[model samples]
Target chain A: MTPSHSGPSDRLEASLAGFDVPAARPPDFPTADVSYAVDDTPIGRMLLACDGSGVLVASLFTPDAAAEEAALQRLAARISPRVLRRPQSLDEARRWLESYLDGGRPGAAPAWALSLATPFQIPVLTTLAARVGYGDRATYGQLASWAGRPQAARAVGTALGGNPLCVVLPCHRVVGASGSLTGYAGGLAAKRYLLELESTSL
Target chain B: MTLPPFQLLVDAHWRDVARLAHALVGPDDGDDVAQQAWLQAWAAYPSLTSATNLRGWLFTVTYRCATDAHRGRGRRPVPVEDPSLAAAERPAVDPPATASDESGVWQIVATLPPRQREAVALRYVADLDHAAIAAALGTSTAMSRRLVSDALGSLRKALS
Candidate 1:
């Protein structure tokens, strides 16, 4: 179907000159069972995913393309594989995130989807969210005790390491047993930045 | 090779895929077919071995979805409203006076046998090369060339 071919194909192409297929709008497209967005923030590039109702996961530090793909693959396996990047759908979450990162108090917290969390991890994360406030820090041992597993400080660290909600769930607020900055999925630098951000906001 | 973000794929080829869907199934079912194609593509994307021929991959998916829509058409209830009414409601761009003649050409293209119609659409509408068309249609490159030539022959005869 070379355009230079001066014959029936050209004539056919000419006849189709004015034929137009309407451009599709975002709403006209089907809703992905899971929609995601990536944003660059003060700390690092973050990957966020949500079902229509609530956020499924947020990666505070998306270091590379492979990390993004890994998060997407996990979402596809656990939820539905029908995922698309629709940033407009995530405006509210972004706004809240920006506000929180800027050291300003955000409005109502975004809804969370804990489907990715194990049962123990769920309780551990819930305790962290409820008991830990902004500008306040808790030791891992304290968090484990608060979650009713006083002997499971090591388990609590493992759970927070895989926190699906990241900053939104306040996992960064949990410090080491001795109150030193320690392992965070986003790395220690991000954890320190988050901690300092909260302390200065006080 | 590391896979690129899925969003990039959607951004790059959505318009082409939409146009292909319209060419295959007409405007009424075009959006539905395209949506199904994208959803399926997303689901299968992570496991995709190569991102090298993504456009061809997308067109292939759209073709399969269009075919499925055709097969299921008889099982689905027919729309009670006039199809023209539905077309009128669509957000069509401003068409020139030659719009009717253009549509007449598409009508001719549509009546061709399925393979020929697909070949014509992939060639003219989607603006894909013979090799890309072959990849999408699962045909040999020589076969795709023959299909397009035969389809154009039919179009020329009908137009004359």
Candidate 2:
């Protein structure tokens, strides 16, 4: 039997693309129809998904193990078949994703529409993104300090751990003060590798 | 019986979310992202009107949770279980690329810290742009870029 590539994009594109209309179906709530692609990065192949939302979910080297499970649970927790709409922009979205996978950096974003509701989280995220460097690392306590809630180190950890967006946010940059990589949502090994990369290159 | 909206949404995005959890926080952190994301989804359930696109909503919630978890907030500690190596109903694996010259990629990646691994995987494997990567790993675009860069550096050195 031919191995199924990780997703239906190729087949879907071939079959569905010919028609201007997508395999349009009434939205399935408890069961949103999902589509995704993979972005090959210098480190590994990342799984890029566009659920019914215009926003993308990128699971880095997500593998077939625990990471995949976590992504599903996260999706379950956010919205349902009752509320959000499935992707109205499949062709545009798929093309955009293909662009990124092909390493055309500008094409990483969807050309048509996206409605991400993460305004409430910009402050802490902004600081982490701006202040951290490629190889450098920060501590959870420091992140709390930056957020002006110095005592909330663990709380910050919670936020990082729950980040719906994974690599794009750089939560891995934060660590424990002991210079020990602690509590990386990805895992300690990934954390160590990040810092190691930073120290060596950036 | 119709699957609960939450279950269906959860089921569809399960693999993606689990991959995010494993790549960013470590296998240990999956529960936290999944639980808090669920809690957030449940809390915001009332606001949902269209079911056509629940995937983004779930990603946002868990992305927020992951960010919070990274910052030392909103973690739900659960019992740890050894990885079964093979789950009963996992997505079928791709046929191995026996000919790709860049072999043992995961092996080297596995050697990095969990955070770095997450960054690396999210960027390299998942192919998320900095924005989506930041959301899952709970950081920002530049920071996310750096993490991936550094991870690549480690791999480069190790492979050398």
Top of the candidates by TM-score: 1
Every candidate's chain B TM-score: 0.76, 0.52
Write the residue-wise lDDT of candidate 2 on A1-202 in tens digits. Answer: 1235754433322221121111112223343433444444444544544565545643445555466544444444443322232334245654553443344433234421112225434545656766775556788888878877788788777777765445556687887788766676556766565556556553
What DockQ was computed for model 2? Answer: 0.03
User: What is candidate 2's CA lDDT for residue A116?
Assistant: 26
lDDT of 2: 0.51
Candidate 2 lDDT over B1-160, as tens digits, reads 2123354455566556544444344344545665666667766765666665466556656556665775574433221121122112222222222212134545455555545655665554344578876776566777776666665666666655
lDDT of 2 at A46: 47
Question: Per-candidate interface C-alpha RMSD?
Answer: 5.3, 14.9
Task: Show the lowest summed lDDT stretch of 10 residues, model 1 chain B.
Answer: B80-89
Off by over 4 Å in 1: A1-27, A55-59, B1-16, B22-115, B120-149, B152-160
Task: List per-candidate RMSD values in Å.
Answer: 8.5, 25.7
- In candidate 2, how many Å is residue A170 off? 0.7
Candidate 1 chain A: worst-modelled 10 consecutive residues by lDDT: A21-30
Candidates in order, TM-scores: namely 0.63, 0.37
lDDT string for model 1 (A30-129, tens) is 5666788898888788988888565656544577888887787777667765567878878888889999889886667888768777899999999898
